[model samples]
Target: EAGRRNLLGLRFPPKYGGRGLRWEDEIVAIGRTANTASLNADGLGIKLGEHGEVHVNASLQTTIPHIYAIGDVIRGAGLAHQAMAEAELVVEALQGAQVDATSLIVPACIYTHPEVATVGLSEEQMRAETDAVIVGEFPLRASGRAVTCNEVEGWVKIVGDKRTGKLRGVHIYASHASELISEATLAIAQGLTIDQYVKQVHPHPTISEALGEAGWVALNKPLHVPRIQRKRLRK
Candidate 1:
């Protein structure tokens, strides 16, 4: 039945057997993009789960104050593009470009049937790592493409540092997780807060717009997802 359902290519997974295991379209897109990007998984082997971090090939620097490292050696997602970006950043810094590597945020893509992509930290990770963390999620049901394609079964989750009100992470379980995560990555990298994102208008009926909605939801002004609605009662 699962095979049949998968073969049928239904937007949702089979309910009889795979009940509750809703396939995320965002994960599917992540995997597809990862494959096209030629990011091999054999080297990484899923050693890290969201916050997994490890440093490899360390060497002290005489001219520079900090040590230099590169490649999949540094723990986290083992995508080549990310590695290349790090390499470039380091090279630029070494050349006295005054680049800031601390602000770089990497995006993750699962690329499964439904697709799953995330940047920075997950809600689970935030809870485990920080005491002051606020999370907000918005469903893809508000997206017109999802409704038009009959594939609106996922959501976007944003994790923010409550103390600083900075976006720490963004996770999405939708049709195009890979593409949608870029905006979130940029926001987190730039230390943009939820309130700032809310002011930016996103085009209607788009999955990317869900990111904006999620940002609003984090700050208590959710749209499309009524469950998290924030209302100020009259005193």
Candidate 2:
């Protein structure tokens, strides 16, 4: 198995409990996490339906003053790291620091055949927030490093706050997108515009260069893609 199993406790099925002649085993570990709730009460909690969207009771609130909530309770991404960032932001706000909680961008990650990771606003959110949201996408097909690493089935997408050129989001679907997203998150955090990233000299023949290439697309100077021909009428 690809995952390591650390033993916490073991349990036998109904058969071993003096019932049916079936066999099953369950093991619970300290680090094991379940996206679903273990218990759902009448007044509070959530449960995932057959289709996987959750049914949540919005009346829930965290134990913090002038800091309403964080984590899965608020309906953003349910990643633990995202929640930690929100917690830190709330703490800073409660300390009378000039902090904006609304600026947070939740990132979603999935580790499957081709790793997936994303940060900041999605395409829909970008369209809803601004009229001039520009997206830059660079495929891994053109990446030399991807070829060298034997992993070339992914993409890097960057969403820029078009009016200000600020980086609004970055969606990385690659081998190590988890590690790559931090830089993008930092860019969004520091308010570094896409132009700044476009001017950056990324090291040669590396997966990170795909980030730089995507930035180039945002700047309208896509390096690998061929120019498109537009029909011109007689002036």
Candidate 3:
């Protein structure tokens, strides 16, 4: 039985796998996947849907020009920071500043063991959208701070555009990754190149240095990790 459990790619039928359950039953088994409880907006006379979401324009203006919406109520990730950013945009638009909300970079973080954080285009997205892409990574095991803290189990990865050398994305899986991702968000927002990122000096023995080192890796001048060699294909 232990050997059977260790077998790879095992499949089970209804009798053993619970496959005979109805779709609704399966949903219950897995756990409910439903939106948060939302109040209808019609009662407020705001022309909202049953979920209390309002459709807004790039400036966050609603169907009624005078009204504006932001946050989870405006159809986006229900994060407070995102809502705050959108609120700022709405204020700017109201002040007659021409705003383009689509270009906004919203950073996301997951607080877990070896925290995960990300901003901007992912590697898969860049490969699909751009002509050429470069990626670099620095493992936490190479980080002095991570080593000292005895929590070296993650990495920092940077994605860049090969044509322009501008940073396209940054992803991190490490202790305090959520905090470190703010730097990445700023880099993507400013269109910083790998060279520029490497130039910014990071404090020694700090986890933040992992980001700078990863930029160095992307530029093929890694300070800590050995460079990876690729086999050239002969024509």
Candidate 4:
């Protein structure tokens, strides 16, 4: 079983949960990953689906018994953090633990300058799925810390259900946006309301404060952006 388990590994360079490139031409031989199943998966009794992803049950187990799959082999954003979470979940499952899918809130981050990060539904997605939606967007120009670091070039937008006040999604486009999104992910995972999120008292003058500002803006109780800007924003 140990040898078979080793054969199931389709990952390369485990330091990160990402796809390894494969060249079709005979000129090169590379390991494929993320969207494609291992070359040996079919012969080993595993099923492949869209984009050549490994098919798994609700328990994350593959078609073959005792052979679970996770990380890039499964369907997801191919993110390292998400893969790590899946790894932990697989471990728990093997240990006879039962967990709900909602227990996992996978946050996506892009490590570029003025990084990009997001979690949960988008405004368009939320609008289509719910009756009413409200959005609060705060820009970096309003962040004192952004000015201090000369990184004022983006905004944070939060979407919520107007009736329930529950946050539907959180999007960030700013410096350290990747780092700032964790709090938003946690809020969404816990179903925190916009009011509850805003009242948390973010530390003064940091990019993270924008999250609180966005929540306040969503509630129509402006914190730092002011009424004049709010009026202009609506226009």
Cα deviation of 100, candidate 3, in Å = 2.6
In model 2, which residue pairs have backbone atoms overlapping below 3 Å?
A: none
Candidate 4 clashing pairs, residues 3+ apart or interchain:
none
- lDDT by residue (77-145, candidate 4, tens digit) is 667787778878888888998744436778888787779999998888987876588888887878999
Name the lDDT of candidate 1: 0.66
- Which regions of candidate 4 fall more than 4 Å away from where they truly are? 1-39, 226-235
User: What's the CA RMSD for each of the models?
Assistant: 8.7, 13.2, 8.0, 12.9
Name the lDDT value of residue 181 in candidate 2.
Answer: 80
The candidate that achieves the highest TM-score relative to the unseen native structure = 4
How much lDDT does each candidate structure score?
0.66, 0.68, 0.78, 0.78
For model 3, state the Cα shift of residue 30 in Å.
10
Clashes of 3: 0
lDDT of 3 by residue, 39-134 (tens): 444554556655556877888877777888888776766677898888888889888998877778889888888799999888889889875888
Candidate order (TM-score)? 4, 3, 1, 2
Model 3 spans > 4 angstroms off: 1-53, 229-235
Writing each residue's lDDT as its tens digit, candidate 1 over 17-111 gives: 23343342432334211221232323534232233333332221212246455545455466777778878877886787766554567787988
TM-score of 3: 0.76
Candidate 3's C-alpha lDDT?
Answer: 0.78
Please give the lDDT score at residue 223 for candidate 2.
84
Worst 10 residues of 2 by lDDT: 226-235
